[model samples]
Target: MVELNVLVADLRAESAEIDALVGGLSADDWATPTPAAGWTVAHQVAHLAWTDRQALLAINDEAAFRAELAAITVPPERMDELVDAAAAEGAAQPPAELLAGWRRGRDDLAEILERAPDDTKLPWYGPPMSAASMVTARLMETWAHGYDIADALGVLREPTARLRHVAHIAVRTRDFAYLVRGEQPPAEQFRVELTGPDGEVWTWGPADADQRVTGPALDLCLLATQRINRADTALVTAGPDADAWLDIAQAFAGPPGDGRDAGSRERERRTPA
Candidate 1:
């Protein structure tokens, strides 16, 4: 298991990376739409900021978090509506205000996590998570939403070792992915082997597992985060179950996502005369 401090440090770094990306954006730039259907750059940042606030509540005041959760009267199936509503409310703020809130919220969350006990279990939308696991989840969201912001800005970010955290959560949530979709995961475990940016192989599951997914680490991370469609990735699968898993993989909690459409990246990259 990774030390809690290390995970918190990585989470801080990941948040900083996204902060730099939006720190200089013009107000107009904040309105630029990203690949997430109706979400703009502002919406992406707002979502991250809102989620950070939720994380703080979970950590510093569990009763408040529970009360907040209980106050939500939406049916489980429509829970995403609340998520979208929160982002919309935050995005409605002035860009400078939104950015400042995000900065303050994330920084405060990081400080709280750093002081949290290693065995601390935080309540979340999904399952309760250890302090380390919560930080990992936050890092995963920062990277995933940062991709949306980068895409909206027409910038390409180089993959880094931080992706290992995202990929690890994705692999660990394989069963959760299926469960959320009203499906049962295969009883057999699937081996996932990814080639990282530094050429290191990051792997999970039994070495002798018949079901296997092999691909560039970036592709797996993007696919798991639903930032890229399976057809747009170089991921390879050796078993029927493995192939099926790739189609519905998601690293985040909540309802199943409608992943990016095939060829969306190609379309975005096209230079029209």
Candidate 2:
């Protein structure tokens, strides 16, 4: 298992990368819509800032966090409305203000996590997570949302080794993915073998398992996060369970996402002006 400090460092790095992307954007750029329907670049950063604050509350003040949770009176089905409401509220701030708030919140969360006990468990919308696990989750979100912002700007970010964290979480959350969708995961274990950015192979599960997923690590991470449609990825799967999981795979918490259309990006690229 990776140590807490190492994960913390990676989280900081991931946040910094996204920070650099938005730090100098013009006000108009902030209003540009991202791939996530109805969300602008401002909405992406605002959501990150808002979520960072929630993490801080969970880590530093349990009672306050519980109170905040209790204040939410929305029905379970409409929880997404609450999330969108928060993002919209935050996105309304001036671009400079939004950027500053995001920087502060993410930095504070990282500092607190660094000092937290190794066995510390933090309350989250999903299951309680260890400090390390929490940092990993944050890194995954930072990268995924960052992708949305980049896509909106027509910028292509080079894949890096940091993607390993995203891939690991996607694999570990396989069961959660199914559970959130009101289905039981297959009992049998499936092997996952992915080629990383630098050609390193990351593997999980029994090698001889009948169910297997094999592909580039970047594609798997993008697929798991629902950033790229499965049809646009190079992932190859064997066995019925493996094939099915790819269709519905999601690494993040909350409602099942309406993933990107298979050829939407391609169509966008090929359309005549």
Candidate 3:
């Protein structure tokens, strides 16, 4: 059984950490653009807050949430464009109001997930997810977007063992990656082994599996979240599906993402633009 309460606690803690980071930023700082093209820091936070509200609706009122999604009228191929436009609208609020809205949504989400029945599935943009998976997905998004804010502010966050949750979801979603690309999922389970922040080995899949991916846990999480391009990281892959999976390993639900380019090269190109 999934320890959903634990996941909820982690989700709450992740949101709190991000809240602390953004809380001290000046209005000017909040206007800084992140690596995500055309999205400012305010846009990042606004997206998180908006998604949180959607998640709450999914949990509490599935029919209403689905109706709302249907009303948006964006085609599958243009979902990202729609999100950017929606985020711009959501980002119109002042920093304080944005932060408050984010905190309110985060707190409400944690509370609802905590009280939810363990076996119940929550509706989402993609397939419905269990309470555990839902909270974990929220935690994953918190960490990923938090990275964008930190990078935009030129602050490097201390990596944490909490990344284990993300890595777990990333490994479990291997097949989803292929399916999202309209490709058939390989009928093989590849081993994944990552060294945690504290030098502990965290692993998934069979010990003797022919296919394996091994890397720093943080790199794996960043790769899964598409924060860092697969080519930029020292992640090792040794199988047919392993490399292909890296090309499309997305932990979150949505259409496929255009991941970042190599780290240093991307920075050089974008910093002066």
Candidate 4:
């Protein structure tokens, strides 16, 4: 089992970094569009701040969290408006104050996680998961949204070799494979090999694994989370699950994303004639 402390340290550093990035931005920059579908920079930060707070509330009050979770499935327009409203509120405060408040929320979350018992049960929007899993989910959320912020600014944010954190979630998205098939999930662990920055490749699962696959961690993360298409990158597969991953690979424990296969057409357009 991974140490919860490692996760806390990473998040503490990233949250502060994220706050500074948002705090330094001008009003125009706040309104600038991010690569994340239909979200502005403010929306991105607001979601993070809101989510961190929600996790805290969920940890202490599962019933209230479950009730609120039900509203997440409401009409798309309503959800959009809700998120937009949160962004507006976040952006309304002074930069330093906003940053201070955001840091406070995340730090408080870290404290809650520190004291969380090993067997603690957390309520998830998708399914019931452990407190540890919730912490991982928070890390996953930070990376994904931070990717969006960096992309819009044309800056490359390098998370230390700890991408193993996000990659683990991506690899575990095996069940999401079944959702694409429109069938029940199969009880099996698929092998995954993902190469990270500096050409370090990480492998999960047994060496003699039947369903072999190898690829860049970026592609794997993007694909599993439906941020990019399998065909859009150099990911290779040599077993039965190859085709399945191509069809669907979602990491977040929820309904499939609308962004899947987004870059496929552009990817094909860039191919040689």
lDDT of each: 0.90, 0.90, 0.86, 0.70
Stronger candidate by TM-score (1 vs 2): 1
Return whichever of 1 and 3 wins on TM-score: 1
Off by over 4 Å in 1: 267-273
lDDT of 3 by residue, 1-273 (tens): 348888888888888878878998899999999999988899999999988998999987889998987887777767888778768987889999999999999899899889888678888777788888888888999999998987887767777778999999899989988887889998888999999999999989999999999988988898888899777788899997898888889898778888887763244233320
Q: Write the per-residue lDDT of candidate 4 for residues 1-273, one digit (tens) a residue.
A: 787777777667766666656767877787777766667776777778888888888888878887887767666324545666777778676655666667788889988997788888887655677777877878777777776666565555554565677888877767655764476764555678888877998988877777777877877776765666565778888676655665677776545566644464243233221
Each prediction's total of clashing residue pairs, residues at least 3 apart in sequence or on different chains, is: 0, 0, 0, 0
Q: Over the stretch 1-273, how does candidate 1's per-residue lDDT look in tens digits? A: 888888888999888888888999999999999988889999999999999999998888899999998899998778889989999999999999999999999999999889988778899987799888989999999999998888878777777898999999999999988999999999999999999999999999999999999989989889999988888999999999999999999888888878888885664463321
Ranked by lDDT, the better of candidates 2 and 3 is 2
Clashing residue pairs in candidate 2 are none
Q: What are the TM-scores, per candidate, against the unseen true structure?
A: 0.96, 0.95, 0.94, 0.83
RMSD of each: 2.4, 2.7, 3.2, 4.8
**lDDT of prediction 1:** 0.90
Candidate 2: tens digits of C-alpha lDDT, residues 1-273: 888888889999988878878888999999999989999999999999999999999988998998888898986657889899999999999999999999999999999998889878898876789998999999999999998887888777777888999999999989988998889999999999999989999999999999999999989899999999999989999999999999988898888888998874453353221
Return the clash pairs for model 1, or none: none
Q: What local lDDT does model 2 show for residue 266?
A: 57
